[model samples]
Target: MNIHAAILWEQGAPLSVEEAELEGPRAGEVLIEVKAAGVCRSDLHPARGDWPTRTPLVLGHEGAGIVREVGEG
Candidate 1:
């Protein structure tokens, strides 16, 4: 399914909000319909190149949301 996500294309670049395709979770994984996502200084680590992360990474880690779906055991 497609969902809105803020993607970081590269270090020192502004985050781009786009529709992202989400594959179904694997075993023991859960799909969350994120309601509130916080952008804290911790996330800046990747943006500043202090923390190594894959390009085009989804920016939000600290989030509060409801469980939309759960993968099978």
Candidate 2:
């Protein structure tokens, strides 16, 4: 599925908003349709190079949403 995600391209850099292709969750995982996401300072820990993170990653971790699908175990 296509999703709008805030991608972190690099540390100390601006977040890039783009459309991303997301696969269904694996076993024991749940697919959530994100309804709300907050860009808090906690998310900035990695963005500011204070914490280590994988580059080109989807940045929203603290989000509220409904479960759209559930993967089988």
Candidate 3:
């Protein structure tokens, strides 16, 4: 699936809004159609280079969404 994501390509850099490809859920997983999302203090730690993090990271874990698909348990 194609979706829009906020990616931190580098430390201390602004997040880049880009198109991302997502695979279907695997075992014991579910795919959600995110309706709302939020970024908190923790989410900024890595973004601001206050903490170590890998590049090309997707942000915003706090979210509200509807389950779109479920994988085998």
Candidate 4:
């Protein structure tokens, strides 16, 4: 699935809203339709280069959303 997300492609760079490809809700997983999302301090650490985080990272793990799909458990 295609979705919009806050992505950090590099360190010390501001996050950009980009088109991202999302895989299925694999076994024991659920797909969420994010209604609200927030970029917390931990997410900033990677953007600010405070931590050696991998590039092309997705921020905003903190979010409130409804479960749209679920995979077989």
- The per-candidate count of clashes, in order, stands at 0, 0, 0, 0
**Where's the lowest-lDDT run of ten residues in candidate 4?**
38-47
Report lDDT (CA) for all predictions. Answer: 0.89, 0.88, 0.95, 0.90
Q: Taking the tens digit of each residue's C-alpha lDDT, what string does model 4 give over 1-73?
A: 9999888889998878988899989999999999999888988888899899888888888899999999998
Alpha-carbon deviation at 17 in model 1, angstroms: 0.6
TM-score of each: 0.90, 0.90, 0.94, 0.90
Residue-wise lDDT of candidate 2 within 19-69, one digit each (tens)? 988999999999999899887888889988999988987776788999999
Q: 1 or 3, which is superior by lDDT?
A: 3
Query: Which candidate number maximizes TM-score?
Result: 3
Backbone clash pairs for candidate 4 read none
RMSD of each: 1.0, 1.1, 0.8, 1.0
Q: lDDT of candidate 1 vs native?
A: 0.89
Residue-level lDDT tens digits of model 1 in 2-43 = 999888999889889998889988899999988999888989
| Candidate 4 stretches greater than 4 Å from native | none
Q: Model 4 Cα displacement at 44 (Å)?
A: 0.9
**After superposition, candidate 1 runs with Cα above 4 Å error:** none
- Sort by lDDT, best first: 3, 4, 1, 2
User: What C-alpha lDDT, on a 0 to 100 scale, does residue 23 get in candidate 1?
Assistant: 97
